[model samples]
Target: MTKRFLHITTLFVLMISVVLTGCGTEPAANDSGKLQVTATTGMIADLAQRVGGEHVEVSALMGPGIDPHLYKASQGDIQKLQQADIVLYNGLHLEGKMQEVFEQIGKQKPVVAVTDQFAESSLIASGVGGGTHDPHVWFDVKLWSGALDRIEAELIKNDAAHQADFEKNADAYREELAELDQYAREQLAQIPREGRVLVTAHDAFGYFGKAYDLEVVGLQGLSTDSEYGLKDVQNLVNLLVERKIKAVFVESSVPKKAIESVVKGAKAKGHDVKIGGELFSDAMGSAGTPEGTYPGMVRHNVDTIVKALK
Candidate 1:
């Protein structure tokens, strides 16, 4: 009787273990034919979705207003990366700490750096040495439009079956981006020559300013993750005094203290200064907001710059 009871308990345990094992072995819940697309930031996700359309299940690793320059991944993120059919990142050292990880993963997966398509001359100096790459290539709609061509090319390479669909969606989005670019030029007409200056939390908008013909001054350098030195603050004070620029801007991702200091400095010098508006520097706004999408983000930026400068 004791032997029979022990045998019954062992069989019950085995059955429970098998049941648990089957539960664990259950396949991924999502049963869609959609591509498991992952992008480093919301901007890239939006672009990839526009190009990939309904065939892809697009997701952003970094949500709106999240800083890519210092973004780090979690265990869940690793699983997502591994599962992704295509892992798209801005890839101008934008992910900063995670750049090395993505570099390694690129060996196994299709990890395409969209920003690599930009010309070196178009990049800003790192200030670390003779050359540094600027990761904020999306600020300029023209530059972003150029990146889309590369994006389309790569998408076509990955999923050739949906080549026509991808091309169709990409072409339409590209046209919209072109139209947004034209709108930027038109809206920026609101600001006067001298008033076309943009003072911001960081130097992310160099491309945008250069393309739009504005004097772009950043309280900090290209990367927000970069520390500010005394010389940096002093230099900005001198420039602000000289330029007599009034509206200093703060970025949504960066701390406001630095720009606030500039505002205080300008005021101490008897110059009227104010926080222009928070700009979407590192990330986009919430999905439904004006800054949610790339074109809307650029449009918001143009409107803000013109409003502040004019």
Candidate 2:
């Protein structure tokens, strides 16, 4: 079916389901009495769980190694969104295909773009133009902390009875994030100035480089859907050779072959760049692992980059 037709069908089904089931005006908590939060990505889900602690049960539509840029909502995902008390997502076209779904759901319930509160000046332009901004704001710990505030506000708006709980949780979580930001700074500083280059499979690390003061080069554009020709690979290879860069990292959400190609090309030119490590870009690591949570993922990326480049 056509993409537009599928979206329409999904919306129709969702509305019918909501009407038949009779969505109540009360907070949509589950039997356990926790606010049912549905987030578009794992990172946002982590934020919701952290800030909504003991009062919210969170689910992420896109999980580990899943790319939100090309993700289309499945019928199951629509059901999750329909059942959620509040929906959270990264804005700026991060969930490109699901924008219409979020819009439709917003008519019935609270749908929040966590990045909506950010100032225009704080965002990085995609440079591919058409006035697009990079959606990977979570790479910068301080910026991602802003999302906690937004999420907390929305939660309180939806469930005011627990405003105090949300506030306390948010404050504690913000403190953890503050420590993480400092840790990232001190660790990344170990890499000498000449070696502070981060070459990755895609341009997902622009915010990371900007936050951490590393020069980042990506083999592909912001979205994984963006195509990369031999010219792109060759250009990156040229940068690696010219700078004598020793490592290039792959992304968990993107194919490894892209960085592998860059490495092969660099090798062909005698630079000997190795695959530094896999960085969690659009996705986190598997569940129950250190690399799975946002702080852990950021720590993992920082440590990996420093180890390879320092």
Candidate 3:
């Protein structure tokens, strides 16, 4: 009787252990048998979806017009990250507030940065010691293409079964990016060198300026976390007047008031500077629109800048 009781207890314990282990295990692919991917921003989501193709399901935590600088992870975002088979984000502190959440999620699964391929020498320096990097590497078409390769490798790492599909999709997208780069050069070349000054709400255009040979001025620093004072506005106004800049741009993600203030300040100094157009910075345009796609966004910006400054 004693031996039989011991055997029953051992069986019960083994069953409980199995249940707990199953609960902790990662989930399999979804009903569609696609690798589930969650990206922190729409740009990353679009890239992942395009690269992953039919073998992956991708979604964005922050959607159109959302500013990643100030965005924080919500409960829904947390839940999505927890359930995702893989997570991709734009690193270099672009998602400033969500770092801790991302780190926590990384413990469970792969949390990859699309921009991690950029070498330190390739990054734009920011801040006191230049210890930090500007996270807006997407503005440079050539630089962003590198991310395609990285994303492909990651997808393959997670779902080796779909390696062929990911590679094919990435190759096709790379060709499209090359064409977009050429288009931007042609459009921007139309603007006179003297008129190639790009003034925007913040310092999100360093990569764009470097790649296209434009001088970029932002009202605020690289990260929008810093405050902008009247002195800063006055300084930019003086620059616009001195340089005879015709147009300044407002960003879709940043508040327009800062750019508007600069315009007002310039006008007060007897220089009429017009608001060129709203540019997609930090965030892409609404989905289903031409501006919503990466290629479309770059073309729209180039056209807007050329038409305004030419």
- Please tell me which predicted candidate would have the highest lDDT against the true structure: 2
Instruction: Order candidates by TM-score, high to low.
Output: 2, 3, 1
Query: Per-residue error at 251 for model 1, in Å?
Result: 0.6
Displacement of residue 28 (Cα, Å) in model 3 is 7.6
Clash totals in order? 1, 0, 0
Candidate 3 structure quality by residue, lDDT tens digits, 1-310: 1455345444544443444355464754478888889998887888898999888888898877888877755556655676689989999988865555566556668989888878888889887464888899999998898888888999999899888888899999999999999888888988898999999999999999999889999999997876899999999999999999999999999899999999999999999999999999888888899888888888888888998999
Residue range 164-265, candidate 2, lDDT tens digits: 999999999999999999999999999999999998888988888898899988888898878999999999999999999999898898889888988899
Task: Quantify all predictions' global Cα lDDT against the true fold.
Answer: 0.78, 0.87, 0.84
**Candidate 3 whole-model C-alpha lDDT, 0 to 1:** 0.84
- Candidate 1 C-alpha lDDT tens digits along 1-310: 2465355445544443444354453323567877777888888988998898888888888887687766656556666666677789887778765655665556556888888778888777667775667778888888888778887888888789999999999989988988998898888977888778888888899888877788887877787766887678778877888878778888888889988887777788878778889888889999888788888788888888778888
Please, what is the TM-score per model? 0.87, 0.92, 0.90
The list of candidate 3 runs beyond 4 A from truth reads 1-25
RMSD of 1: 11.0
Q: Which candidate is the best by TM-score?
A: 2
List candidate 1 stretches off by more than 4 Å: 1-30
